[model samples]
Target chain A: MEALIEEPGTADTTWESRLEAKALIPGTSTGVAFKLWVGGLLLVLLVGIVAYVNQYNNGLYVTGMRDRISWGIYIAAFVFFAGISMAGTLMSAILRITRATWRTPITRVAEAITVMGLITAGVFVIVDMGQPLRLYQMYLNGNWQSPLMWDMMAITVYLTSSVVYLLVPMIPDLAFFRDRLPGRVPHVQSWMYGTLSFGWIENPPQRRALAKAVAILTVLIIPVAVSVHTVLSFVFSTTVRVSWNSTSFGFFFVAGAIFSGVAVLIIVFAIVRRRYHLEEYITERQFTYLGYLLAAMSMIMIYTNATEFITKGFKASDDDLFAFRELFATKFAPLFWFYFFGGLVLPVLIVAFKRTRTITGLVVASSFAVVAMFIERYFIVVAGMSVPLMPYEPSSYMPTATEWAIVAGGFALFMLFLTLFTRLFPIVAIWEMKEEHETRVEVAP
Target chain B: MIVDLRHCDGCQSQGTAPQCTLATIEGHLLPEPMEWIEVYESPLEGGGTQFVPTPCQQCQNPPCVNVCPVAATFSAPEGVVLIDQDRCIGCRMCMAACPYDRRFFNWGSPPVPPEALLADYSMEHQVQAKVGTVTKCDFCVDMVRAGSLPHCVAGCPQGAIYYGDLEEDLATNGKTLVSFKDFTTNNNAYRLKEELGTHPRVWYIPGHGEAVGRDPHTTGRMPTKWPWIERAKGAVTWKR
Candidate 1:
């Protein structure tokens, strides 16, 4: 773990450790925690691979999918991951837009999560497709009239913009990594950092150009993220299906996604801070701000849910009545109420209270909110499709082992991506933290 | 021409082979009918149980077609609604769009014993069915393509359930045939729910005289050879 934070001026002991490393084991906490995290992720990935193979062999029958319930776990997971992605970009953009001084420590990590989250979300879509190999068909023979095409366009654009947004902020950091690391690491590694540094030498002109680019990107990414989820909602909302036909669906989906996204960010950042012992860098103030954000999002989520249900419940036609009864009083009632109370309402109360304002308390509330968001997504999908339109008895669907496996795999993939990410780059934005400190000291002077 | 329900007896003798005008595999036609062409005991401004022989509407602007993503259910250029099983994803979007609740998806491979597979599979006539796809009345497209009247049309002794060319403006039941427009106007015939604009090809003429409120099951024997109709009853199990 000591290697995780390299001591720059230490001499003559670096190359010697590599020779004695075989005999002597390093006792770094970062190394042990990282290994354990990577191992857990691998287990999940294995489950996913097995599930995907089964799906290929047995077709979509492995899922809780019937003709009426054509989409199930895969689509919901895609929506969940996409919602998480919205947090990183939106939170970063908000901070940048407001010119928040305290946003320094968390911004780059959030952007990293954003890029990774969107990529995985896109992967889930392919996994859900009946013909993954023929996925190009959608682009080749895509119907412009269909809302799915709109989703494709929006997600692709968002993914590209997010990668650029993430990388643009890292140019200065890559230069730091290049100079700070010992020489003779690798020619390619040196070349990569050297090239990406764009000849940046901490000059005023260079700093101004990098800052200007990041500011512009931050401004651009907010609308693009909003567009991604709004268009995703359009895939269902544009359909004539009774449950999905509401005008409020787009905003409702977006709000839920943002709420969940912030929750995930809190959890991930908390773990990273704890594992890396980044207490000095990431102070308690960060937790307080995140708690405030969570409280705000929880309120918004509660408002959206009430609006959707109240409006839908008011116009109690036969279809509407059946849908409402299914969600509020029948099989999905438990999940629905759990998401409402535990996911949104409880989290809001905890965050708003004076007693539970600590980092641990906020983490606990945010975790519940994220978990609740997942349950909410599941209920939305299952309840909406489970209601029978005809006078016939409604069909019952239960996801098989294969479906469960893929869901496990998706979560595994998320952890794997994040774990790999930390090893390759700094979890906290090193240059930004230094800059924030420098600026503060200069102001005081 | 209008089916003169008063003069027409329930015994339909003019039907072609494998076709029954008054009775079907499910039930028999009776004077107080309980058959496909059943008369409803509806309170009219005039009051009576009306006899109406219902068949596949063969709509021009079919609702089922518009909602099908896979284009499985579609209207032919000649305006007969049909289902192509090969292309169907079994998504049941067509079943949801159909207001009449006429479409059915095969829950299990249609119960044709192995011997039936000896017959060829044709889009014109679905001889063997696979499970997990939709089925519905195809307006007897097979007979229409062969230049013969539909089985239901030939079976009707009362000159009900006509096969017609909407393009040619001609219609024929076995007993009586007439120009489509002239007969429609002369008989005060009307399509069901014309306001919905489905553009249904099937027209109904109100029952007359003794044929009203007749139960066909009391008078006729239900056919047993075609087991496919018996399986259609299984579709009714999907109700909430």
Candidate 2:
């Protein structure tokens, strides 16, 4: 394994250090952990399936949703997953556009999260839809003018762009795996990886072509990311519903998405970095830098939330006031406060304070922020709907066992994708790291 | 339709003997302003409430029609807005678009009894009420299409609501059939928000003698009948 990693054509010192890092941990045994993880994931999935079956047999009645609170956990899960997926696109686009050197070590991890998050995001939409099978008919006979259509279009574009972005960087690594670890992996894996390499003879033309595709996809993903969040906001804002009827909803949603996305990336990257024994590749500096980035986003997120709440509160329209009261003074008050302080303020404060700027502290803060963002999405969706328009109290929502099971299943699904991805390919973008080493003259991790 | 603002003394004192009021299909008699026909205060050209009793406009180019993604809402050939409940996605896009906010979403199972659900539902009429679909003043298309006056038209004791055929240039308030054009022109009749270009089929002969200016606090509901509904105030109102 050492000899394979330190092959002559690979970049010299960095590859040697990474090989040493891998030796520190017993390789091959992770497959056991993978098995356990997969088993747990399947259990979660089965539980969720049972709950969903119940919901289907009965009506949405099993859920707490009333007419006043039409949206709830499903929409929150959708937003959380969508927000997390933006990490890949934003990171890839930033790295590609600026031609950043140090991004190589973390780009693959980020991109894989994006793909998994997006798949779950798509699934969340189905869970939210009262009529899931009819979701296809949304395509067959869609209203182009509806914001829901725009959401469909943007998410599709984002998914396509992320897959292409992931693939462009995987070509050389697939070739490496094909040649280096033949019998260790399954035959089907070998054939798929071999085919994915597109017959790369380790030649200059193939590298150039792959690089060009990567560059194009990187650039293409940014607008798609922005569009997805914007269209999502439109789904709520296009309505006359007072609280959601703001023009600033797009910017607010996008800022929140990016903030949450960055936090998820930080947490996922930390986990993979530790598990893969890639300490030498992903340095402490990366965490600190990402820490600073997360802090900036947290501040921006705070600003966006303040903007949305203050302006709407001033209007005092019956519906808007009712919405605000529900979120701030009623059933959602605790969650709303928790999201604002725990999700936004605390993370920002921890990163800002000198004492908590260490790598471990940053990781803990990032994880907290991710959880808080999910809470925030839930409050925004469910609480927003809690305000009834007529002479009535807004509806109340409670997720049944089925809803809880599905949510757990979604988390397990995310972990499962990440687990499968790391086992099959180099968690780090090896070729990009090589290029960075050759060009940047940065110190070896 | 005309609303005599002078006569409406706001929501009449609860104990006041009711002169006029609106009753729902369920036989719940509400105050005058709460009637199927609403009298709104309008901007006065000079002075006095420009009382307008708004019934279902039965619009020719209804704003509601353009917003229904599933074609759930369509105008009858005779010019009435109708909803095909079965086809509605419960998205409520039309409810948001209507300037008058006339549409209502059935957020949960309607309060109606199970026996009422046995009737057939059609695009021409709404009978079987479903949970999660929208309902509104459908201009009683089912009745009008059957060569009859709408329920509200027949229910109005003041002859306040007029059903009409624009193509035949005729209209009737059940008591009087008048030439649509001459009646409108002679009465200085108008549709609400003419500049919005909604092309409403319902026309009104403005009343109130001129006390115009919308009182923000005064909703259209007026004082009216039924001791039982008032006595049963604490009972849960149906979701519909």
Candidate 3:
């Protein structure tokens, strides 16, 4: 086993080659820790399935949702997951478009997060439905005019493009795995690598073709990602609810999605960097740059929130007053305040200060941002529904045990996808990193 | 339909629960917490409470119909918004879009009497309500077609609810027939949330139960009941 491990920097005599063997180590080996982690995820998934079965049998009444506050944690989780997906695709696309050399190490991780996040997001919509079996009707009897229909179309297009975006750039890496580790890996793993590589030889023509594909996708995915979040916000904005009836919701939701997405990316970078022993590859520079992005988004979110509230409050109608009271002073106040201060403001403070600008600090700030964004989505769905439509007293909603279990399941599924993908494929784009290192070495002399 | 608020004492003078709501529930075999024609006791501007019996407005430009993803809910040719439960995916976008809070969902197998299952299902009547679909006051289009008054109009002891045809220019409150245009114009009738552009067909004549010989200060009305749920087998009920 020790003899099978290649020496650092042997192949290319560069720092990029030093991490190449280390990057493939996770894909080649299965430790007890990895198995235990997967076991835990499967257990949570089982529990979620049980809860969903109960909900399926007994109807949506198994959850705390009712006629008045019809939506709950499921819709919120859908929004949160969907929001987090944006950062991965958007970051990869933008960084690639700008020719950012530092992006090479983390682009693969970002794309994986986008795919898994979107799959989980789509699942939550099904879990939230009262009639899951009727989902096919969305395709068969779809109303093109509805915002939800538009969201369905947008998500499908985005998911397809995202998968292509993630896969197309990794063909050379797959060919590397096929050539280097044939006898060491299992038959199915070897087969997957060979079949997916599409006979890549990394010649100039193949490289040019890959570059053009990546270039087109990088440009195309931005508008698709932007449209996805905007259409999602339209699901709320097009409604007649006082809090949801805003023209600026399209821009607000896009900003919020990117904010949460960047935070998630930072957190994932820290975990993958530490756990996979790739510190030399994924350095503090990535965290610092991503932290700046998180802070910038936090500030934009603050501006959007202030603009939405001030403009709505300036001409407070009777319904708008009730909505304001519910969000600011009444039932939803605690979550709203926590999301504002703990989630948005604290992250900015952490990133802004020189003392707390370390990797660990960025991770903590990102964790806060992630949790805060989820709370924001929750209150947006619940509190928006809480405002009384008529003169009657406001309605209330508290997610049931089943709801919590299902949500936990969604997170577990996302982790499982990342975990399994890391085992099967290289997490880093090795060829891109090597290319970047070669260019840097030529410039140095 | 026209609801004369001046005559609506919320069935208080009759010493019972709001008869309009009760009759609709019985007539439709609706589940608990689904008052199709609910009587809301709203606080007056000066200092009093008034009962406003609200049914579905049957809007000509309904937000609910516009936002249904599967086109399961649609506006009828007669301007009534109806939901086809068989086609509904139960996404509840319609419920979110309705400003009147009039729509109801069958969260569980709704506790309807067994006899309701025997009746043929129709979009107009919504009999044998299915689980996980939306339902609301469909304006009793079937009864109106049959040359009979809606259950709410007939059940109102004060004759406050008038079922009408704007195309025909006529309306009746089970006691007297009148020109729909003349009655609305003369009584200063108004629709709810006119600025929302829903163009609601239901109209209201504002007052505080004065025509029914009741003081505006009377606040509470009897809570609605699902009297048939006691005999409903294999069905469940949930709170709103």
Candidate 4:
């Protein structure tokens, strides 16, 4: 264990330490359960592909979207995925910048979530397009004045920078896998690790360079993440719709993104910790700390929700009255209340109590949060569109089977990417954990 | 364009659908639920209803044009907001941005008359309707270029609609010609949603159907129709 924890430049590391590190590498000895899980995800992905083909063959008429309610669950899913992508910025970048020692075990999971969430979010945007093939026009005739162009540019930059952020800290770990698991794994896997490791010898100069790169990225990613969500909010706020027109929209959306992001991170952490037998690294202490975050975010969400509603409801213009009716008492009331009580309030209560603050309790709270945030996004899109733009009656929308299938596919794709990432790379940052361990040992009297 | 709401009875007295809506639909070969020029009966503040013949506002500061990611929809030099369906990606950002709800989407293949398929397509006269793109009232720029009134202005039985050139300072509703400035000033004309600063070219002289001797309590108008004898193959229609 001592030899394994030592700097990678040390030549005296024993074969036994390599074998112990090798256990962290998944897919070497695949279990039936893992195979079954992957197979199921792929099967769902296949169904989604078939449904999307049908939607393509037909036009957007197959979906629930119509003239008045031109957007639907697809846009909601896009916002949901984009919102959860804040996980990496919060857990990896912000935590790293702040020197939060306990974040080592979960950074890999959070960063992977960010990348996969963004990729799936991008897919939904394409799926929502009536002329998916004409998407190139966005680049060729792109209007810099459009909020959507800003969104496209922001997401692209965020995705590219996040991939770099995820990969930079993993260089040493990839090098470890490259050297230790060469013949043990497939040649393609071995080659990938070797190529991705970028010829790391882990000398002092290389360490200094890697540290500097990570420090720069760690500082840069937070603003990028915030800007991505803020720009997304501008897509709605810039419009003239009564429900969407708000000066507070940018800040409100960022708060919501981080709220949903932390909830998803907690959920992913719990699953990864149990599934990978990482109890030693991801302890109850991490869960407790994240629970506090979840609780705090829930409070922020409540406050923002109140501010948005109270400000609008107090004014009660003819348009505002109709919008309030639709959200609070009419067609969308059930969804709105579900999100308000079950998604926001219940999580706070779970974390506030001592007995239910255990890992199981927090996971339950987080699950609610995840489902509720999705509902919140749904209402935001659907209810905002439901507000009658004209004097005519408000239009309604319900997701068709095709939309539901495609949404399922998006989620499956997200899970599949995350699952494949875990099989290929260590979900835990081994080097970071080693560094944390070393620091703790040195600090001990 | 000026819509004289005082004379507009929504074609109630004429005992037909709003002539403006019918004429524009027939002229453009528009599909079902796409009334390019719709007659909306809105409630007045004091008591009863008023018939507002609403077409595209032709805003100088068009919100739809501002939000279009591809610049597919743009304000022509004529100050009419026109959509190039060929270039539109059908993201519907413009549709959402349109305050009037005048914009319509061809969700599926639009069911146009077979003859409409033969007409050469242009932004000034949107024909050969494309699937997955937005369409709206183009203010009959094609007819205007030919030195003729728009179908809606010419078709109004009560001469309630007017076509005019602001630069020329002249206006006409087929039978009668008037000075544009004098007509607007005398009638106290106002544009819809002027608070939004869209600076719409279409003006309304607000009133119930009082001048045409139709009661405000007579609320409903005849439902508009597409009047297609034969729709193109594999074409479909959907609700707004």
For model 2, the superposed segments whose C-alpha errors exceed 4 Å read A1-32, A441-445, B1-121, B126-137, B151-240
Q: Provide the global lDDT of candidate 3 against the true structure.
A: 0.91
> Candidate 2's residue-wise lDDT over A325-377, tens digit each?
78888888888888888888888888988899887888888888998899888
Candidate with more favorable, higher TM-score: 1 or 2? 2
Q: Which scores greater on DockQ, model 2 or model 3?
A: 3
lDDT-based ranking: 3, 4, 2, 1
> A213-288 in candidate 3: lDDT tens per residue?
9889999999999999999999999999988999999999999999999999998888888778889888988888
In candidate 4, what are the lDDT values of residues B150-212, reduced to their tens digit? 989988999999889999988899989988899999999999998998899999998887998
- Candidate 1 structure quality by residue, lDDT tens digits, A1-445: 3455445564356432322221111111235666887888898899889888877655554566655555676777888888888877866887768877676777767878887888888878877755456555455544455456678788989989988887777887767656654363456666776787777788999889888998888888888888888988876665545777689888988888888888888888788777655665567888788888889988987887778778878877778888888878887888888888888888888888889988888889988998888887776766666665433356766677888888888888887887766655545566666676767778996
TM-score per candidate: 0.74, 0.78, 0.98, 0.96
lDDT of each: 0.65, 0.68, 0.91, 0.87
TM-score-superior candidate, 2 or 3? 3
Candidate with the larger DockQ of 1 and 4: 4
> Model 1, stretches more than 4 Å misplaced?
A1-30, A182-205, B1-240
Q: In terms of TM-score, which candidate is strongest? A: 3
Docking class of 2: incorrect
Query: Model 4: how large is the Cα RMSD against the reference?
Result: 2.8
In DockQ, how does model 2 score against the reference complex? 0.13
* Candidate 3 residue pairs in backbone clash: none
Recovered native contacts, candidate 1: 0.01
